[model samples]
Target chain A: MHIQATGNVYRAKAVTGIKTVTDILMFGAGGHAAAVSDVIRDIEDFNISGVIDDSPSLQGKCLFGSTVIGGRQQLYMNGLDTMAIFLGIGDNLTRARIARSLGGREFPVLVHPTAHIGTNVSLGEGTVVMPRAIIENGARVGAHCIINNGAVVGHGSVVGDYSHVSGNAVLAGGVNLGERCLIGIGGCVLPNVAIGQDSIVSAGSVANRSAPERHYIMSPGSRIFRRFEK
Target chain B: MHIQATGNVYRAKAVTGIKTVTDILMFGAGGHAAAVSDVIRDIEDFNISGVIDDSPSLQGKCLFGSTVIGGRQQLYMNGLDTMAIFLGIGDNLTRARIARSLGGREFPVLVHPTAHIGTNVSLGEGTVVMPRAIIENGARVGAHCIINNGAVVGHGSVVGDYSHVSGNAVLAGGVNLGERCLIGIGGCVLPNVAIGQDSIVSAGSVANRSAPERHYIMSPGSRIFRRFEK
Candidate 1:
């Protein structure tokens, strides 16, 4: 029997002698892709078929036992129904755009078995809940988000679409993150706080108050500024 | 068969027919208690008898399907030998004081089943390692401590008695935290850093330097101050 979760529901498929493992194609060739490959290997349910990267230099290179087969256009050439797709990009905006490009394609939610998700927690399509991450009761993690290793989504917290809650970052109770936000490594959002769309709370920073759209909230007393704006 | 783990030891008790489940009493009636209740429910080997809180306002209130029984005096009035106790208080100081008040009482360590405790890690009596928490190789966590949800005690770290390592906090390799310290939410203690007794590193703060006793360290450029002092 092979158990696979699609969307938020799990279904067990009966197979004869050996289990039928699914083929999963990784959609990036960077450091984040390497980490996701490790997690996919650890899961043992899927075989990494190949890696897809737009960078010309990465083509034909190997990562996590799979070769970089081709560029982003190859995803369209190959049948999308033949294998599962996992978003391996860490940047929220890039990931969101790639996800939009692959519109309506099957991107199963990949939750590492070690992750502890509490009652009534909803993980959206293509979201990856990594090792030792905790999504507490009533939390809703949006589509294509990465709830990274050892991260915590406190009770009733809302993580918006394509947001990346990095390793050991915390979203305390009732905190709301807008689309494409990056809660960096070991960062924390206090209870009931709201961070707007495209905001980046830098590594090791504390977000105690509400932040506006497109702002970068760095170290304490440092000015919050819009990215790419002088 | 009933298997119970104490410290680093697991003992199995043979029982005829149905397995014996231990009754556990929660020591606090707060948000943390609700979280711990969910973990206890997930474990299945333990049953929550009720919650004990000293607050007069919350004495009869129900939380997570369990009613708050009475004051601290009820603990002694009821037979302590019958059930195990789990500290659900989030504050290190209050938990320490309550543990001391319940002198000589048995407080079994509660580790969430999903928590990853690596080789040779030692968790002391009354310590609660919450869901998805990681105690890496050779780490030692002392008695009556809270290793909150998704917190990571890195390789060879030593967490002292009555300390509270909050959700998603990271104690990097070889870090040492003294008794009654609070490593706040998403706080990161750099490799080999030592925090003295009764100290607190606020949420999302990085502790790169050794902190003295009874001080609160918040943001960069902020002077550490004693709790009672202005």
Candidate 2:
């Protein structure tokens, strides 16, 4: 498979027939992993070989038709050179930690066929754009990030590494999210707002202003007494 | 076209190339109609013949290249047998009234190509599932409903007739919405919650419990002292 980098986006070109399917080792076998597995099954070119989960109980169990092989140590068994990995962990920090531990290994960016990714969108390695997620024009999604079901990353928005934009969340045009940020379900970040690293905009909360690092922009009612006004 | 009924769901089977393009008359010339029109254009088998609106200002005006002809009387002029109708009105009550007046007239269910519909999903006539909307497994959407942009109908949820699930709204698994209900933008109805008839869930509000009939569950701040508490 030949990958051509245009601007910041990497577009993969298939070598017809020979590269019909690529084996992918899934990291994490939780609920998010199940969802990601559904998307991987829908996508024609990718195949899940096995799941890698830390939980001992899940080690021999099957998740979405794929067996949980072992923990992070299983990566060595598959050989990173031949096996591509998909980060299935939902938490931003844990996903980032696992990605960093892999050294410089690049994971394939998985986008569901139903997702409407507009022109000039840049998706980093190991980023999984879920079903019906819209990453609009000029939006940049960082590595190991999860743009979950029906989420909309509006035009010119920048989602930093290891961030998770939950289902039905909307980051309006030109919005910037720093690393490890969590834009919760049904959350709406207004245009041009910047959310600092490790901050979390809770579900259904509308962020009209910038939030500092490690802040929690909870629901509107809770925001009244909170230190951060916006 | 042979429409096979399996339980509550109707699956329409295509009859080769003979019935490729379907002539559809849109019954609203408003902004919501324009959004629906965009989806109609994207669909391969459907074609918008014209628009029908009661307002004189909108009449003869073009909406997405389709001109507004007249009022409900225009349906007779166009011959309803030849052209299918789509209700593009945004208001739940207004859309319900319009659908009732057009008794026995079935409308085509429009699903945007980018929208992800899971297995065994049942969508009713005149229902419009907009771009990036996710209708998960076993979910049932009623007639003339609007599942707007980036909205999600979670697994096994039931949305009543003439209802509107607004943009970025999330109706979690097994939730039930009564007839003519409006789940507003960024609103979320938690799992198994039931919203009564003609109820309005205001934008960004989270409904953790059931709402009674003719109620309005406003945003978080407004939910503090409401008469009809969910």
lDDT of model 1 at position A203: 79
Worst window of 10 by summed lDDT in candidate 1 chain B = B9-18
Give all candidates' CA lDDT scores.
0.77, 0.76
Looking at candidate 2 chain A, the ten consecutive residues that score lowest on lDDT are A221-230
B121-193 per-residue lDDT for model 1 (tens digits): 7777778778867788889888888898878899999999999998978899999999999988878899999
Alpha-carbon shift of residue A28 in model 1 (angstroms) = 3.0
The best candidate by TM-score is 1
Error (Å) of candidate 1 at residue A14 is: 16
* lDDT of model 1 at position B209: 91
Give one digit per residue, the lDDT tens place, for model 2 in B1-230. Answer: 21211221211221111234477788988899899888877776677888899988888888888888888887876366556788989988899888888876657777777676665567777788888788765678887889998788876789998899998799876889999888888788867889887788887787767877777776545535566958
Model 2 scores a C-alpha lDDT of: 0.76
Tens-digit lDDT track for model 1 on A1-230?
Answer: 11222222221221112334488789998888888887776667778899988889989999889999888778777464546678899988899998998886667667776677766567777788787777876688888899998788987789999999999789887899999989888778888889888888887777877877777777655577789956
Candidate 2 clash total? 0
